[model samples]
Target: MREEAPRTVTAICRALQEQIECGLLPQGGKLPAERQLAEVFDTTRITLREALGQMEAQGLIYREDRRGWFVSPPRIAYNPLVRSHFHAMVGEQGRVPETEVLSARIVPTPAEMCARLELPALSSVIQIRRARRIDGRLVLYVEHYLNPQVFPGILDFDLTRSLTDLYASHYDIRYGRVAFDMVPTALPAEAASILKVTAGSPALLITRVNRDQHGRVIDCDVEYWRHDAIHVSVEVPD
Candidate 1:
């Protein structure tokens, strides 16, 4: 028999990645049985398990105790700068939260975005595009990016629903610390279209990052506030 090159976990992950790329495995689909994979690769059970573990780490799959691994879903988003929930934010000034999800997908993070999030190159990221309205009047257009591995099934969530509550109840993510910075600018054509405002209208671009009890970054969100509608509250540091 020809000498067989030792199979490694990286090789296993690469094999699965290729399968996914070729559509042999579709999104939201379960992975093969561990034993079947082990047999196909002609590898020891331990080596097969190592491969599975690597895949899980890369957000390709998720495993439940006593249950097998399944393909992992995308991540959800919430801003940490403001102490208000999504519902509360919309409800401010007695406005109803009306939201429409424009798009949700997984993509390789761009260099600019990766730098902001401090993520590695080519890491998988979930992007959410949405429009928010108050009293049936559009006021904000948002593009959210999240790390899918941390908060799975985020894309399946009701986009109009309160993401903050969902994270707290489902994922045990409660942001204990929040910080934000703001910059003033004229609304671009794209943002104006969704907000139903004229181009060059004044706007506030707010950047926020939040940390959980364990000091892990739970959420990082950028908010676009209509100039006429938003108010700033601050305390100056000595």
Candidate 2:
């Protein structure tokens, strides 16, 4: 019957999911090639891929750009409510965190970012771009836009280190009240390339608009995180 296709795909997906959860497919272990898996399951490649897609969506597995699917590692717990920076948070969870500055320069603020930073047209913002990794796997790519006036000569500082510490010590400025917005998105080409994933891979976009001590908009950060690499956590205090 026509209705059998969905049932077949769901069965394949559950079988693979069980393998992953039961540790038969170890974390970071590459899955067998598509053809091999299809043969093993005695199903069409199309059906196998459909099943794999379900696993990817459920965060049980992931695919790299050129590399095939692999069992995912434990997700990093991300608490947007916490003030700690990337390195600190990863360290607290006993995972290695690495950041590399991709690019840094002064650039005319893009219209969308200009609004977020509350800057006027033709204004310049110090833009620093970086890619972050966890446990030796590429995970996040981020772009930082800062009001040039507020952070004079910001480019001189090492951009790979924590922005929070850079200004806290150099400019006597600390992160003040902040706002966070998160959305599900497909990774852009640039971000996906840097993170070693296929373009349009699933991603989580977190936009942070930060204000200074006096309540003035100081900077904004746009972060693209590999969906399977992070677990969003928010704890409410009683």
Candidate 3:
């Protein structure tokens, strides 16, 4: 006998939840197609979709446009005090990290940016935008603003590689004291589009100011990360 709509939805949700809990559907694994999943659950497409929607709301799954749903991966641990860059941190967890440079240019520093970097009025800053991924999933988008006077000719270098390494190698400027500010917010449109997530999705906004040994500001970084994609952790002394 065909079950009632409510009962059918509940049963399907329970079954899929069990699959995830029991590791039958591993983290980061793609869920079966909608048609296949519906047939296996012996439910109508609408019911199956309802079940999937429940899972997505619970952060058990996520969808990419033009791509099917995937089980959510465990969040990456991020320590604000750690000096490691994104690549090292992701690699330490055995996940592949990739970066794509979206744009690099010299633009007049905005008022707020000038204050953040302590730049003089009418200063020009080198801005670089990048998308960072882990295991082929977009996790972070960043905008880097560099002091042009400190890093002359920086725009001529290959911007796709790690900026940390570039700073050390090309300019002998290693990271010194750093400051971090984090906030919970909704993803902006450009970030949402690049990350393949809907606008207004929950996210973390992290702002970092990097300095050199001489206490001179090197650059400031603004990073936006999916709320479900990272876990921030830090150890504080008693």
Candidate topping TM-score = 2
Off by over 4 Å in 3: 1-14, 34-54
What digit string (tens of lDDT, one per residue) describes model 1 on residues 138-168? 4567777776776899888786676778778
Count the clashes in each prediction.
0, 0, 0
**Which candidate's lDDT is highest?**
2
What's the best-to-worst order under TM-score?
2, 3, 1
Q: What is the C-alpha local distance difference test score of candidate 2?
A: 0.91
**How much is 157 displaced in model 3, in angstroms?**
1.8
Model 2 lDDT tens row, 20-126: 88899899899999999999988888888988998898888998867899999999998888889999999999999999999999998999988999999988889
For candidate 2, the per-residue lDDT at 97 reads 93
TM-scores across all candidates? 0.60, 0.95, 0.86
Weakest 10 consecutive residues, lDDT, candidate 1?
A: 72-81
Error of 1 at 237 (Å): 12
Weakest 10 consecutive residues, lDDT, candidate 2? 1-10
